[model samples]
Target: MKKLLVIGLLTLFITPFAHAQFGVKGGLNVAELTGRDGESASYKAFYHVGVFYQAHLLGPLSIQPEVQYSLQGGNLKSAFTNYDSQLHYLTVPILAKLTVGPVFVEGGPQFGVLLNADQSGNMQVGLAEDGTPAYGNVSRPATGSFKRGDFSLVGGAGLKLASNFSLGARLVAGLNDINDVQNLSGINDPRLQNRVYQVYAAFQFGGGK
Candidate 1:
């Protein structure tokens, strides 16, 4: 029943795009977490692959919607300890695009559904409180109940390299918090939200022109 509902919704949403050009896109993702109270972290390398439809609505104006599987997460080094957190998401991004000659610019909102979350590190022992240990023991392969849904804003530009191939880059920033209680220990630590930079190439199905 759930599968049927999703298929129905996708069909409805993609009907308009069916009349336009379709393509496959894959990209590299540099992701990290940011918020008001999270630990210091570094960007982790990930990737996204998906299909998109570009429907031209007017002169030099079009609407593009994409469905992709994205891997997003970060690594943390706090208090001489290291942690790695990784997340998998199914994302849908809708963009309003403007094209001139061989260049195009687009911006829109991206919605994501979390498929998986994982953490590996020496962080289970918790952080120091007043220079004292907080957790009692070290746990391996720690788990957290993170949020399932994510919302973000994305803006990007692309250059046509040929009749059928294009290169692009995009910036994606989270609009909502993606934190869990299990990851927080004190009142001073901040939350976690996603920030990613993407670089990709697209291959059009019908000559990509």
Candidate 2:
């Protein structure tokens, strides 16, 4: 992880001499996870802030990458119960941008490292609507930590606003599982997954030749 961070920072510094552009971005996230059975899902709001750099590779094409701090997770509610979880992560996305006239479309892969997670609300063992105790305790023992890497798909669209600036919005969808909970003596079911979606606005500071 440290090595990846170092390489990313180095790329940021060196790219400017090779037709690179830099920018700042902030955005909103609507996060939810897919589940099995007839269970429904809920959404939670998250936020992100980041810096990015891009290098022009050819006419109408460029390689754009970013480093960001993002918040993601969701709230769960079912009939008589409510539970919420929040997660923080360091995320890196590498994208290919395609332009036509004033409009551009981009898509790429993103990597995330979980920084923290917090949970709250009604959390205990009881008879669920299905006549089973879905969860076994108010607080289960924390198992292994969140893994160091999460994969996601990212894509978006925007327009060039000025000679050296542009604005855009993007959606990030998680493609990797993030559950780390282990066996809880046959009472706890690992039903929740850590998948999320985010929308963001970006402001570019430089342009290519």
- State which candidate has the highest TM-score: 1
Clash pairs (backbone) in predicted model 1:
37-189, 37-190, 37-191, 38-190
Please, what are the lDDT tens digits per residue for candidate 2 over residues 38-77? Answer: 3356888888899998787777788888899988777666
For 1-209, candidate 1 gives per-residue lDDT tens digits of 99999999998787656557889999999999776343577999999999998886667788899999999888876654567778889999999988898999999999998887887765636546666556432434323556888999999999988877899999999988777555454432546688999999998777553
In candidate 1, stretches whose alpha carbon ends up further than 4 angstroms from where it belongs are: 1-19, 36-38, 125-143, 187-190
Candidate 1 TM-score, C-alpha based: 0.81
**Distance from true location, Cα of 201 in model 1, Å:** 0.6
Evaluated against the true structure, the overall lDDT of model 1 is: 0.81
TM-score of each: 0.81, 0.74
Worst 10 residues of 1 by lDDT: 135-144
